[model samples]
Target chain A: MKNQAYRMALLYDFYGEMLTDRQKEFYDLYYNEDLSLTEIAENYHMSRQGVRDAIVRAEAVLTELEDKTGLIRRFQERQKELRQLQELASAAQAANADPVVGDYLRRIQGLCEQLKQE
Target chain B: MKNQAYRMALLYDFYGEMLTDRQKEFYDLYYNEDLSLTEIAENYHMSRQGVRDAIVRAEAVLTELEDKTGLIRRFQERQKELRQLQELASAAQAANADPVVGDYLRRIQGLCEQLKQE
Candidate 1:
């Protein structure tokens, strides 16, 4: 659906607690539950504008934290590097690597994949 | 000094930007530079308690971010696992692995050590 969930997951995973508890509640409903802003406003008994302001402020906090820390960016970068390394291992194995050694390279490629999931 | 710098470097590297500009400045001197709190307070022209509060709050933010995301912890865990995998590679090499395969295992060990430093 190309929803914001993927980005939200990245941002919220990194800095969700930066939001106030109240803000987090609304954020979960809006992003995680895919609830409409008006639905959230109705449920929370707040003005739509008030609900939106809280969400907007929360989103800003998430974005600002990301810009400042760059943790998520670095993480994604490391993942990219790991995948590249796996490819390199495959190349190394193909380049006249001994069969036993080729086995070791395959194991390493597996490890790199494991690291990426972490 | 077994001081907070090592811890700070990890925290800052992971989530330093969550701090206010003022908080980051003070945190650098206190943790990164190992300045006494009194010195920091004097330099910043703030009350001692004010300086302390700022640093404490900043530390809390870093710690909380780590706890919630588990990114740093997961990072450390991966490093550990990589090292262990390297050991497994060595074992594979020792158990009658071809000489060329042994070289690959050695190279993988080196890579694991490199990853730990990151």
Candidate 2:
């Protein structure tokens, strides 16, 4: 549940460019910069309700893009799958596999790390 | 170069639902059904140019979606990386890794195959 915010942040990363300038600013302030609605309103010389509405609109756009493309869902799925692959590779390497086989398994683990980061 | 058509098909898989029904029909006819513009036009009682235009518009929509989200490109990258992982795992198993390690390596290869299919 705590990662829900992280997912929203990732959605913004994928689709924030499509949002209007004002929405983008307010969303970054509230979500990334961790500013309260009142703080964003004061800084932007807008009402708190306006800031809230803009962020909500940005969220809607991001969610809609994700729904249409399912990119974020696929990304998370890949990450989960990669983690499983990494675990298996690590287990194999720890089992005293042959030196050559260990080297290959190590390479596999490295790729899983890199792919997960991507 | 030949895979260019395959890439477009993958893009359509991700974004074709966003296209209009007509565009989707023409695109499917031209690409998936391997129908020529003339054949699709004859079947739909439209001009060849109309069928071509619809397919192009559908292509533009799919291309835009991919450009905005980079989902298809990312998917391709992951598939390529997983293929590499599969190769590594196969090499490890073939190198006479410990039987237990071989089992794990086999599972990793299986996951790579499954993920690439996804």
Candidate 3:
């Protein structure tokens, strides 16, 4: 459930602008602010069911956008690859004593850091 | 002009599905298929100005999305970084005689190649 919530938050980050204003507000309150449906409904002067429906619609829209674009998936894959590359570089750096090889490994690690920090 | 067209094509690749069907068709015909505004207008029974307008609208929509997301810019930067990483790995591989250092460099090069192919 936690993983799924995090994933939905990321989807919102990428495609939330496409949501309707009410939907965006409800979804953000529920997901990011951890608001209860009753609380959100009271705040907006809406029924709990109405708030639930809007949040669900917003989720569907965000997810459909992600399905079409695959941008988030690609971003995650690249991040994983960078992590793996960094680990391998660190291992190689530790094993090698040659200053020349050390220099190259250092440069490679720098590149990996830059990629990951993005 | 050629570089700009290529960049527009890439923007289309990222966000074309969001455009209206007619906008997508006209943009692809003009940019991807190299059709002139006149040719596209004739094929679709649209005025030359109409075809031009649709293409321009599509371009504006794609640009707006890019401005909001910056995904293309990040992709280009990562690709450039990968190329540099590949070159450094290759140089290290060539300069080192240790099979172990060469092995690490070879693995690093493999990772770079995988990333570039994506």
DockQ, per model, reads 0.37, 0.67, 0.55
Alpha-carbon local distance difference test for all models:
0.77, 0.80, 0.83
Write down the TM-score of every candidate. 0.76, 0.83, 0.87
Model 1 DockQ vs. reference: 0.37
Total residue pair clashes for candidate 1: 0
Model 3 Cα lDDT, one tens digit per residue, A1-118? 2247988988878777777787878887888888999999999899999988887778888788788778899888988988888888888877787788788889999999998877
Cα lDDT tens digits for candidate 1, B12-114: 8888867789989988888778788889989878898998888889888888888777778888898787786777667656653355545555666676666
Question: What CA RMSD would candidate 3 show?
Answer: 2.5
Is 2 or 3 the stronger prediction by lDDT?
A: 3
lDDT of candidate 2 over A1-118, digit per residue (tens) = 1236787789888777777888888877777788899998999898988877887778888888788778778878988999998888777778863788878878898999989987
Per-residue error at B62 for model 3, in Å?
Answer: 1.2
Query: What share of the reference contacts survives in each candidate?
Result: 0.32, 0.78, 0.43
How close is each model in CA RMSD to the real structure?
Answer: 3.8, 3.2, 2.5
Q: Is candidate 1 or candidate 3 better by lDDT?
A: 3
| Sliding window of 10 residues with minimal summed lDDT for model 2 chain B | B1-10
- Candidate 2, fnat value? 0.78
Clashing residue pairs found in predicted model 2: none
